[model samples]
Target: MFDHVVFGVSDYAASKAFFLKALEPLGVMLVSEGPLGIELCRPDSQSSLCIRRVEAKATHLHLAFTAESRGQVEAFYRAALEAGGEDNGAPGLRPQYHANYYAAFVIGPDGHNIEAVCHQAEG
Candidate 1:
């Protein structure tokens, strides 16, 4: 039901860097870029991630990324912190989001809510 997702950021350079580092672990790459936004794509997929600079929206936006494992989720959280992201939530299981929903949330450079999640029983 979705063709693509476009996130509005305050600074293109900062948001671009943040996304590059945060999504690198997922095998996503920036395929194209322009003044409007940077287009990203999976290693061999057509779908894209388009990030652009825009006036901050009144409504908060939340984006969730799937991690290959819990470890990746933790790494993403750490990387986000290292990249100057404000901590929203630490990597851990959250029954509220869902049973065995191990995830982490970070405030992106654009001030948008970003999340990395792993949905698997922790055993």
Candidate 2:
């Protein structure tokens, strides 16, 4: 539905590090970095998420990324916690959303809700 999204953060370095670790499990990596911002992209090289340094306080936003499998969702949660993210929701199947809606959520360094979701049915 969207091409890309940018998040404004107060502490660029910290937010960058947090995202780098958290998104690693999803195969998202740093595509570009500059004084003002850093961009992360999937293996396809399409920039999907970006974090920009801002003078104003960062605003909280809910962002969700698609995961290829349930294991990736779990890995994202573990990586996010290891990178200093606060737990919002543990990895599990959200039957309320759908039968195969497995997901995990965390609050990032900038206080934004970050999520990884897998829609595939259990094998």
Candidate 3:
């Protein structure tokens, strides 16, 4: 539905490091870097996630990435915490969204709500 998403951050280096570690479990990696910021993408996807340095402080934004399974959601939460993310919501079934909506949420360095969700039923 989207080609890419860009996040404007106040501290480029810190946010970049946070994302690099946080998104690793999802198989997203740094694809390119520049003086202003860096870009990240999954191995097989054309869509990218870019974080740019801006003079102003970044506003809160909610971004969710798809997870292949519940286990991946759990991994994302763990990685996010280890990478300096604050816990917003722990990994669990969000039955309010749907029966199979398993997800985890974390507050990113720029205070954005980052999430990883899996929409598959548990066997």
Candidate 4:
């Protein structure tokens, strides 16, 4: 449970564009922008992810966003790939984590492991 997470991207424009498009299904929107960078989050959520321009290599990290349903996870996976993200894992169950854990993973523009997951059983 973080209020926000900040990270650097080698290509600011590319990484920013990738996240904005890829996270559309999750309702993430640009919240603010400043000299520091840009902040993005869903309108109703206080948490956000901020991307800043940097020349050094980005430190890779896994970031996961909760999905309201399995459909959102599927949508996010497709959108992320179309937005130039590399597929780390396709949308599917990861019963090892939990009986109803369904998720999709993608390597983002900055090599961050981005994921969307739903913990509910399929209807």
Root-mean-square deviation (CA) per prediction: 2.0, 1.0, 0.8, 0.8
lDDT per residue (tens digit) for residues 1-123 in model 1: 455788677777788898888877666788988879899878777677798777754246898887878988988888888887899999998998788899999998767788999998764
Worst 10 residues of 3 by lDDT: 10-19
lDDT computed for candidate 1:
0.83
Q: Rate the local accuracy (lDDT) of all candidates.
A: 0.83, 0.92, 0.92, 0.93
The candidate scoring highest on lDDT is 4
lDDT of 4 by residue, 18-83 (tens): 999989999998989898789999999989889998899899889899999999999999999999
At residue 28, give the lDDT of candidate 3.
95
- CA lDDT of 40 in candidate 3? 97
Quote the positional error of residue 42 for candidate 3 in Å: 0.4
Between prediction 2 and prediction 4, the one with superior lDDT is: 4
RMSD of 3: 0.8
Cα deviation in Å at residue 111, candidate 4? 1.2
Residue 82 lDDT, candidate 3, scale 0-100: 96
Badly placed stretches (over 4 Å) of model 4 are none
Flag regions of model 3 displaced more than 4 Å.
Answer: none
lDDT of 3 by residue, 1-123 (tens): 889998899988888888998889999999999986899999999999999999998988999999898988999999999999999999999999999999999999889999999999986
Collision pairs in model 2: none
Assess every candidate by TM-score.
Answer: 0.87, 0.95, 0.97, 0.96
